[model samples]
Target: MDIDFLKSQLEDHDQSQLLWYWESLDKDSQEKLYNELKHLEFSNINGYFKQAMEDLKHASDKIDNLLQPLPTEVCGSVTGSSPEELKEYNRIGLEEVGNNRVAVLLLAGGQGTRLGVPYPKGMYNVGLPSKKTLYQLQAERLLKLERLAKQQTGKHCTIPWYIMTSEHTKQATDDYFKQHNYFGLEKENIILFEQGLLPCIGFDGKIILANKDKVALAPDGNGGLYRALRKWNILEDMEKRGVTNIHVYCVDNILVKMADPVFIGFCRTKKAECGAKAVEKTVPTEAVGVVCKVEGHYQVVEYSEITVETAELRRDNGQLTFNAGNICNHYFTLDFLKHVSQVEQENQLKHHVAKKKIPFVGDDQQIVKPTEPNGIKMEKFVFDVFHFAKNFAVWEVLREDEFAPLKNADTAAKDTPTTCREALLSLHHRYMLDAGSKFIHSDGSSLSDIPCAKKAKESGDCQKSENDDQFNKCEVSPLVSYAGEGLEDLLSGKKLVPPVQIVMGPSDITPSIIQNVTANGTTN
Candidate 1:
């Protein structure tokens, strides 16, 4: 827009102060700024600017309130555990899957910046034996689940997979999936959508320009899922597809069970509109959010918000009172999401401010990267809607089998690609052992030659030996078994070589087992 129009619009919204730097810009810069403003719809931009100003003014008070310890209660009442309970949950979940009442939503908006990669996090390979990207692994899991549901129900069904991408990672993610042929899933069953983004604001409550032509912006956070759902009409789409429950998860988790039936079944059986899968915190001081009830409403309390005393509190059974660690895996009924997305209840979710050193153009129109935090980015978390759920459920899961996240670069000690890879391999090794398969190193030595064997021998722990494999690696395909169950018949009496990948059918088994046999062949 021209200067006169811009001035009138700003004046009409009482935001004339934004024009302070307008005259200082060169012709090119002026055009760029004007185009950006126009694209952002200058008429509605003042409200956001006003909100940002107010947010900046109250940010300090908000931080103080967020720091205060929340009153937490034991989560056991809403938590489910035990194999028998899992079986029941599985039954219910499978029924839903058979009835085509389930879908999977993957939160893949974030880039692999922490991992020191410029690509999307979903495209990063954690050095798996099959060299599968996160997206590919998740897709394969969904395909396997679909097959399982069909087998049990004796009817073909499709579980739609929805992936949320951010502006920064959307194109790269789309191209990656296209290059991989949607990882063997039917193309029509996969849906990819971009999440919303909000402009970054400086500490002084002014918008920061990333360069001469662009404004600094970031994803609106996972809580934007609600808004995105409504914006994309996904709820209506789900209804048309007969989807009742959504398995929501983050892309960083390498061991996530996609569209897990047990989780869905458990929530349905309990008549819960929302459910979360939580793993017992490894220690009282672990830097993970704890799922607990605060003021009789379900919410996750970050470790920073809890006192040392409360963090260490234990129950009579010797488990930590607030042991349920929120792992970002949740099951939400379509109706619950619809309720949360309604216009009247939209404001129930709150925004969180994150301080960061956002790169921006200086007064000289040159880009400057600060060494310290220079701006604030406001975000909304997906879990903030927990309080709106009238009925909520929490399920306890084993961390080792279900929760390995790839979050950092190799320099970090935990949650790095190396650690995630090791966790995947170790879990596969355990599955092989459970199926009565033996392992041997390249030199024909038993796996006991590794360091884990010495510790297992000292402690006389058979279970430890089963998973110890410092000198070996194994990877299991979800197509073979979802949770390492029912593999005995396929693997019994076989000697699995190190660094093997096991998939469905004998034809796909890798590392060349000691004996290759068909249904008609007998083992030596």
Candidate 2:
């Protein structure tokens, strides 16, 4: 059992009490706890705890002098590009997809603690008509994208989906996909690998025990992808599958386009080693990170790190100077990822500390969930590696169409379950408007204008406006049409009412209407 080795290591870190229950545990329990203790990475626990505690002191510091807007050439947007340019980008992106050169990486290690759920966020159903979870929706989108790519490029394609989970969420997430038969995706193509975990430490720099037999551990954030990839040989697997370009994104964005052709095409044409998909911040005080140059290096400057004056700065074109709001969507070259993953310890990304109301077992052998922050969990943000990119590009998308994050439960005012569902519905409603569909009341009154009538609002984001509530309740399944395409065949010249749901056959995505609301907003 290497008793001396274990004792010396724990004693060196002053964490010897971690094995307080070792003698009392049964053989199987002792074996489990021993494995956990062996992989705790406690050699540098003291260093990590000290660094975490010291980081809080400068957490609010601002670097306004170093902050500058992303260069025009490095930034591409739907508003800036002409229709021909966008189409060309989509073609290139689809060509890459059809050639089987693209892969998608989903960062979904978080438990739904903030959302008041005991499972992973990807398993959450935001009250959609189909009651599909985030993972299912994304899987369907990928299926559609593969079909679209094959149709466009005239070649068979498979866009591999790699999801990163954590110790707390891996089993649940793994079982979910298995139970649903991988949501129509190939079981092998959808790879599930776990990110690294770090031990949570209390104020005294001592490791907190979840119970007498276990340490309180937390996932080391999305930034741990680099290390995890190396550890799990994920990069080698991607290479084996012939994936050259990777699209990495968070799993919480309900409107996230899976392996978005526009984003992939933009980065491919620019030959960028790394790229970010961002939304223009309409409000200067919006609580989102800005994709800007920090000290001449491309990085996402946190909202808390920028001064009010810096955020409020406007350009000659009457746009916010620092407008590229990061959405945790990115593209990376496989070679660049490999290079980053192999860096030595000195050049590793810094781990940021998160203070939380950690749950732990007291000396009295009872579990206690603290109401106040009692411990720190060290993590690395995925964006922290931006500075390592030699050629970085930013693609701007409409906020309403591409970036409604799901974080909190329905109780929160923003980024809640209700809000996420509404965002997807509103975007689809606008898609129908563009496709020559009209929203009609039960009595044949107009609830919304037809396509040609909306001149000033070309993007169809007005459906998300505070005054309009009808458009927010409708839903268009991803299988029917991805990103509003192919809707013309179904919704063109059609009259639809509020709270309608447009879906297709589960096994086959042929255009079909599933349900429509009556006068009382419920289907008969």
lDDT top scorer: 2
lDDT of each: 0.76, 0.85
TM-score of 2: 0.92
Cα distance off (Å), candidate 1, residue 408: 0.5
Put down candidate 1 lDDT per residue, 1-524, tens digits, no spaces: 57798778767755454455677778888888777665554443345555655765665441212322223321222244667877777888988998899999989899899999999999898876567778877887887788788878888988999988888888998788789777778888888888888777677656677876577888989988888888888889899999989999999999999988877877787788988888988598999998777776778887866777778888788888778889999989999989998866766666767789999888776889999998878778888888887788887778888999999999998999998988787787788888988776445556653336556667886445333443346677776777787678878877654556675532354323423222243422
CA lDDT of 6 in candidate 2? Answer: 88
- Model 1 worst lDDT window (10 residues): 62-71
Off by over 4 Å in 1: 11-32, 39-82, 441-446, 449-470, 504-524
- Please report the candidate that would top TM-score against the real structure: 2
Model 2 scores worst on lDDT over the 10 consecutive residues at 462-471
Give the per-residue lDDT of model 2 (tens digit) for 221-310. 899898899889999999999999999999999999998998999998889999999998979999999999988888888899989999
Clashes of each: 0, 0
